[model samples]
Target: METPIKIDISVIVPSYNGMPLFKTSLDSVLAQEGVIYEVLVGNDSPSDGETKNYLNQIENKDLRVFHNEKNLGLFGNLNNLIKHAKGDIVHLWSQDDIMNPNCLLETVKFHNSHPNIAYAFSRVEVINEHDEVIDKTPLSNNDTMSALTHTLTSLMAGSVPGNIANVSIRKNIFETYGYFDVNLKYSGDFEFWCRITEHLPVGIIQKYLIKLRRHTGQLSRNPKMWIYRIEENDAILETLLNRVPKNKLKYINRGLKWRVYNQYFGLYLNLLRSGDNKEAQAFLRVIKKYSNISGFYFRYVILKILSVIKRDKKFLHWLYYKQAFGNNGK
Candidate 1:
């Protein structure tokens, strides 16, 4: 009698409005080699026959599909999928992202070699809607680091481990530390990373193991969600600030201010250009609240002035990209 392959990992893809790209995403996942794993796709779009029909036609024995009857949004679907996942380690993947062939193999190897780590992630190649590589994220050398280091790095670079597609977590850890907060629509992943790294060490796989697709339809790019994004970011930064020692608190605060400026300032401009006055004002209030942090006021003044000029908008845009991606707007 032949023995069944022991499933050590479950790649749970929470899918909704995830087609065309979902086909490519699932294909990359199904192509993963050198590991005995199962793919569990939570079809949040139960009413969408295209996604449902496509999933039904796939013949892989390792793939299992389930329907949600109704849409549960992103984190809700992820939470539901985690409950049904069978592997000790769960890789919660984005529906539009593609995994490298060795993503699962390399992730499994990292976890096996370091059993103490509750969470880990890898670098990503940023791709546009057409699957053409546009840019890659900065490399992380922190194969292992203390909780303090992880939190500090997160404050500085904003989710230092890269995309949620590359993140792998021990399923058991969810039971202990809690699951992704469905309340946060935009910054939930960043908040979750902050929450977990507070108690446990997070490791980096040091390879570009995923392709994070950037498209106009993604929720992160929506100007309508800016209010929620800033609110959640404020809460997350406050939580992290409370955890730091007094001596290091100032440095973390500085990094937090710069991160807010670098990350959302452009989005604030977008909201203004799109005539989302209410959201733009809300973002301004956030900047004003953080303005007490020494040099932050000057940053706000300079960016606000530069944002007014037609020619300087490009400089401000490049400045944001350079700081955020670290590749000089590649």
Candidate 2:
């Protein structure tokens, strides 16, 4: 009699509102060449029949699907999926992202080799809605949590040089550290990684193994939600600041500058979409308040002022994102 294979990792994908991209994600999982794993898909949007049915039609026996009667949003869905996850490690799947075929096999190898590492991540490639490569993110494993803070507002989970799909966390972390906080209207993922990367040991695979798709219909499309997200992140920074050592103020300064920039940047994008600039300056006010007009942030703030003297919107996006994400191209 043949012995049943034991699953090495369980990938839990929390999905909603994605029609075209989900299939590509599933296909990538189905194409894996090595490693025995189970793919658990939490269909957060139960009413999303098109997404549910497409997931149900997959031929792989390693797939499991669950449905929520109503949408639980991103955090709730991930919480529910983790409860049902049986793997040693869990990969939070985003519906719109794509993973390389070797994603699982390679990740598992890293986790085993570096047992002290709580989880592992790889570099990510940014793609258009059409899956065309638009840009590549900095995936260098050079103290990401500290390096990114040198320019951005908060140490982001997504900015951990990888996408969620490229991350495989030991289920024990969730068991001990607790689930992603639901009260964080946004920034929950960033907060989760903040908890992990700060204390726990982590390692990286050093390969571009995932894609982050940028599109118009993404949920953060609601500028109000982004505004709220920014606010929530501000609170997180304050809480973290209280806990970090006074010697780390340099990190805090860098983070503060990034936060203020994004506050205005989000407002800027919303204004462009809505054709309103008068109220948008409210966000700009806070940005300028903390902007390092003479320092590292100088490279960004000066460009925008120069561009405005030159009259350009494209320069605005570049300048704003350079502030929000550390000139790490969006």
Candidate 3:
């Protein structure tokens, strides 16, 4: 009789013509030890066919490859890959990310020990295009932060579990919470992570698990993608704000507004200086849409005037720092 395979985790990578970079990412996953995991690559119909040709050349018992009929945008591609996953745990890996050898082993161990947590993310080393480590995600004193704290950090500061490579989720969690929203081009993962935190406590592994590569070609860095991100942030904030307890509402709300004001407002100033008037107006609308905090328009007008006058670059830079950070650049 043939034996059934026992797969504990499915490391899914959704790819679209990243070529040699995808090879590096897949190689890292294939090298992981001490875990019964399968690597699934969802080739999102790359025009170049390079990924398909490359996958055909590799022969590994643990690797499975699936090709999409058409290009499903990022989140849609992810949802498609999730459907094909066969493991209890699903690890969404970016096509350009490099995983540490122990990443799968450590995550499986963490899940085995803490059975109640829906998802967990490990710290990641942020790497540049040349594969040099530039920075990393912060370490938490505890294994998991409270859902409220995680939500606040995700909404008001920067995203927690910053990229797909750092996070691993139990397959059932997707069944319970639904898939990533396909409409969100740039921020769907951020929105989905926030949604999960609403009901479950998210775990954190202090170890650096992956090298998240940063390059200009990524959607998040493109100026054109920022508008989509702004649109998604509105919905994300509304859902999180409604979930906060009344006692914490006031402070959380204030912090949220301050974050929106600085984030979009700073972008608005830069757009104006660069003479990208249309985008600058779009960012202005986003700031007005999310924040009702005082001094926004006042500061906007000042920055606009300074930008128009073409004042000293140093003074404008200092003024921006003062306006955006205020009080020791908080």
Candidate of highest TM-score: 3
lDDT of 3 by residue, 1-330 (tens): 989988999998988888889988999999999989998888887575778889888999998887777889878988988888899999989889999999999999988887778589998899998999999877767787667667656666556776777889999999999999998888888888898888678888888888999999987776656766777677787887787667657656655544445557777767889899987887677667655535776655655676688863444335333333334233
The TM-score ranking, best first, is 3, 1, 2
Winner by lDDT: 3
Off by over 4 Å in 2: 1-4, 139-162, 220-223, 262-274, 277-330
Give the CA lDDT, 0 to 100, for residue 269 in model 2. Answer: 53
lDDT of each prediction vs. the true structure?
A: 0.78, 0.67, 0.79
Q: Which sections of candidate 3 miss by over 4 Å?
A: 291-294, 297-330
Across residues 1-330, which tens digit of lDDT does each residue of candidate 2 receive? 998677788888888867777878777776776888888888888778898788777777888888888878788888888888777877777887887888888788877777665566677888887789999866564522342342133342233533466677888888878998887756787778766655555666777777778787776555645546666677666655665555545544544444445445646556757866654655454445445435424545554676678844455444344444443535
Model 1 is weakest, by summed lDDT over 10 consecutive residues, at 320-329
TM-scores for every predicted model: 0.84, 0.77, 0.86
For residue 137, what is the lDDT in candidate 3?
76
Question: Residue 302: error of model 1 in Å?
Answer: 4.6
By the TM-score metric, which is better: model 2 or model 3?
A: 3
lDDT of 3: 0.79
Better of 1 and 2 by TM-score: 1
Error of 3 at 15 (Å): 0.2
| Local distance difference test, candidate 2 | 0.67
